[model samples]
Target: MVRTVLVLGGTAEARRLAEALAEAGDRLRVVTSLAGRVSRPHLPPGEVRIGGFDGVEGLTAWLREERVDAVVDATHPFAARVTASAAAATSALGLPFLVLRRPGWRQAEEDDWRWVGSVAEAAELLPTVGTRALLTVGRQELEPFTRLSDVWLLARSIEQPNVPIEAVLGRGPFAVESELELLDDHDIDVLVTKDSGGDDAKLVAARRRNIPVVIVRRPPSPAVMIVSTVDQAAIWVIYGHATVS
Candidate 1:
């Protein structure tokens, strides 16, 4: 018998999990869903669907109609709504559910960092840290930083901010030296980012230059089975399906 799985995917971890499941042959049937926010996302394996499943009610009905045996939410760490919806919908149906959340970054002794509760708070806290800044909080949250217009800003985003910004287009896994050069070239006095961790280059670059950093912490997620990597999630799915079978 084949096991049907639904992966709420948009993160790097999500793509990896889908790849691992794809290697498991016909024993597992995988369908990966994307929010369609990114214009050109890194496509995952197996079956793929774009856009939301409306909301919780819509998702619950879809699960019932599709006969999905398990669900894994591998959305971006900041994607709190999708995560909550997945948790609620799966719990109601007694379906197996898991979240693949990459671990967050830690501040070290050499780092000068201020932890803010939200994006708005991070914007408000910026003036205390430095006068010129680079906002790496992604494109959506760029609006909050506009209030700090007095400070020279260099923002990075794959999509352009609606408002006029000194924006740079790039993705992560940045090299520390490359990050340092960008900062030094722009005369950036601070770096603002979310604590959604993967590579440490940009944060480390700030530390090397003695530039202050304002990090917006992640929002609380709904209680669920959370794992940190693709391997762990894959193991859980295989083990879970075996146990149920």
Candidate 2:
């Protein structure tokens, strides 16, 4: 029987996992569910569904209706709500579930990293760090920084933010040289970002310029089986088990 796998996706790891599963032959039916937050999102291979599945009830119904055999959540680390909903829905159905989360960035001794629990905490600490700040915590996350009248905030996002702040529109896998130029051009003394983990180009730029960074730590998540790499996630989906070490 061809088992159907449902991937709750958004991040780069999710995209890569879809590609990996697509190449694994005809034993699996791969369906990726996107949150549709990005206007022009990079799509994955196989079948795709956009938007939320409402809450736990909606998702549970969808899973039952679609007959999803296994679920893999490859969403952003900050997307705790979706993760929780997926966990609950899958648990109630007694279906196989996995979380594919990439490891967070490590701080070198030379890197001046100020870790905060939330965006609000980062907002409170921003003024003390520097006068000019580069906010890379997504467009929706820019509200807290908006209230900081004393600090000059420049936010870079894939889409234009509704909030009042200087905007730089771009996407990632950014080169370090370009990031260096952006920091230099903006006269950014400090940087505020989330610990999204992969691609340390911006962090490298900050370190080169000797700028302190206010990084928002990821929130606590529900206990579930998790793997850090796409290979592990693919293994779990295919073989029903992943060697987590």
Candidate 3:
């Protein structure tokens, strides 16, 4: 017997987990859903679905109609709303749900880290830290830094920012050497990023340089089974499928 699985994926782990499920063979039919935010998102292995589903209600409806057996919340760490909605939707429908969050960056002995709860808090801390700033918090919240005209910003994102604030467009998993060069080129004095853990190469580079980073906290989710790696998720899914079969 085969089971259908829906993976809410936007991170590397999602892609990996999807591929793992595909490798597990005909016992599972996997579909990975993307947010359709990135202009050119890296294609995940197997069947792909893009765009939003209104909200939790719509998602619950889809799950029931599609007869999806399990759901994996493998979105970016800062992607709070979607993850929360997934938790709620899965719970209301009594579907097994797992959250796959990559580990957060660890601070070294020489690193200077200032933990903040949100992007606004990080923006407010800019005045005291440095005159020149590098905001890597994504394009969506660029508006917060626009009000701080006194500080020169070197903002980088895949898409161009809506509001004005020195923006750079590029893709990452940037190399450490390249990121260091970017910091030096922009004369960056302070770094602002969400505690969006994972293999975000640029954030790792900043940490290595002992740069002061203001990390935005991750939003809380409803109590559910959580796994940190794709491999773990695959095993769990296989075990569940076996039990049901």
Best by TM-score: 2
**How do all models score by TM-score?**
0.95, 0.98, 0.93
Candidate 2's C-alpha lDDT? 0.94
Task: Please identify model 3 stretches exceeding 4 Å from their true place.
Answer: 207-210, 241-245
Models sorted by lDDT, best on top: 2, 1, 3
Model 1 lDDT per residue over 1-245, tens place: 99999999988888889999999899999999999988988899899999998889999999999999999999989999898888889988999998889999988899998999999998898888888999988888888788776788889988777877789988666898999999999999989999988988998889899988999889996777788888889988877733221
lDDT of the candidates, in the order given: 0.88, 0.94, 0.84
Clashing residue pairs in candidate 2 are none
Candidate 3 clashing pairs?
none
lDDT of 2 by residue, 111-176 (tens): 999999999999999999899999999999899898898999899999999998999999989999
- Model 2, stretches more than 4 Å misplaced? 242-244
- Which candidate gets the maximum lDDT versus the true structure? 2
- Give one clash count per candidate, in the order shown: 0, 0, 0
